[model samples]
Target: MEHRGFTALGGDCELFRIDLGGGTLAEGEAWVRQMHDRFTRFSESSELSQFNASAGDWVEVSAEMDALLRESLRAFDVSDGLVHAATLPALLAAGYTRDFSLGSTPTAMPPPPPRPLPELLSVRDGKARLAAGAAIDLGGIAKGWMADRLAERLGDNCLVNLCGDLFARGSGETGEGWPVGFGDRSVLLKDMAAATSGVTKRMWGPGLHHLIDPRTSRPAQTDLHEVSVLAATATDAEIYAKVALLKGSADAAKWLEGRAMGWSFV
Candidate 1:
């Protein structure tokens, strides 16, 4: 059986089951909604939004939030700061203050200045301190994280695809693997996640989208429009995809040589 949904995480989402056993499909939906509510920056009441609003102050966060933030830091490190979570101001400057699913908003705002990683985050003891005048948007990592989390609840015969980030459990009905496709390639994945990032999607202004270059605090001028990476988890794949796109085709290939990653770029 399969189910599809839209308007969650500002993109299409789906769940597929094949002899599933661990958790009910409804439970998956509930978890998605809950995470969406907590992480979405479009709402003022969201935990992320509250954190963004509370700049220069230490705010307590739940375990999920702490984990997510730590993952963001890891993404920052792995990508060499090419991808980051604290890009709310940059996104707003690029005219992405509203949800892209509702269509684009073309208002003008000041672009965020480049910031060091230490200036972006200070997390300890289940609390985080956002630098003054800095804001964060977890949209980049949150969807992939949600995909990984949802995949854990399913039995050993299911697939979770949330906003193009995916996690599959066990092999498909044929026991080969679940096939996932992206630029110039298709991967048969079982008990793994695949995430693809693209600059072409979520366009707002002349050159703006969800992906931001931390150095310039604007849409990265990447040679590849899209890049896909397969990894053990969706968040890692998502981070790799973005980093690969930003590094272009050649460097991405070199970076993937020693890593257990399969990538396709265009």
Candidate 2:
């Protein structure tokens, strides 16, 4: 039997769904919608936004958010704070706050003031908590996590593509790996998720891009066009790809060598 999945992820376009020749797509779609409903800030009642909007010493969140934040923290240290959601304000300060569809170029107005890092953001009691006034942007890893969730909800016979950050289970009918290309450019194909991070055309200005270095509080100074990694988990591939791109190829290669994670740089 075949199934369908669909939802809107709140970043670029609505993350609508399309299922082909599948049965029980509604169950899968409903589960996917549940995820979207729980996560989308536009919904006005998402747990994340509620927590961010709430007034308390520490607003707590669900287990999923806790787990993902913990994973992100590990990535932060492993990548030397190069792959962090906490850097979103830095990104916006560098003229990257606009919607993705507006294109990848910076606006004419001066960039916003630099945003300070959170005083405390930690997981406690199986809940993710943020300090009273620390805003976060999970755009870096949320999509991959959603893809993972959808893949888990569905059996291992399909592919999950959240705006081209894709994850697949099992082989295609042709017995060949699912073809994944980066940035809607290039002819390369692989079985794993491929995430492309650059100052995308939308965030380019004064030789600056959205991807910032949390340690230095500036755009990362890396001589890499893109970085791609292959791993058992799509979340891993996404996180690694972003971290590698920020780390640049040299440091990334060293980091991967330490972890023994399969990767490629272009």
lDDT of each residue in 158-212, candidate 2, tens digit only: 5666654556655644456554554434333334554445545434556587667
The CA root-mean-square deviation of candidate 2, after full C-alpha superposition on the true structure, stands at 5.0
Q: Number of the top candidate by lDDT?
A: 1
Q: lDDT of all predictions, in order shown?
A: 0.80, 0.59
How do all models score by TM-score?
A: 0.92, 0.73
> Model 1: clashing residue pairs?
none
lDDT of 1 by residue, 14-80 (tens): 8887865768777888889999999888899999989988989999998889988888888888878
The C-alpha local distance difference test score for the whole of candidate 1 amounts to 0.80
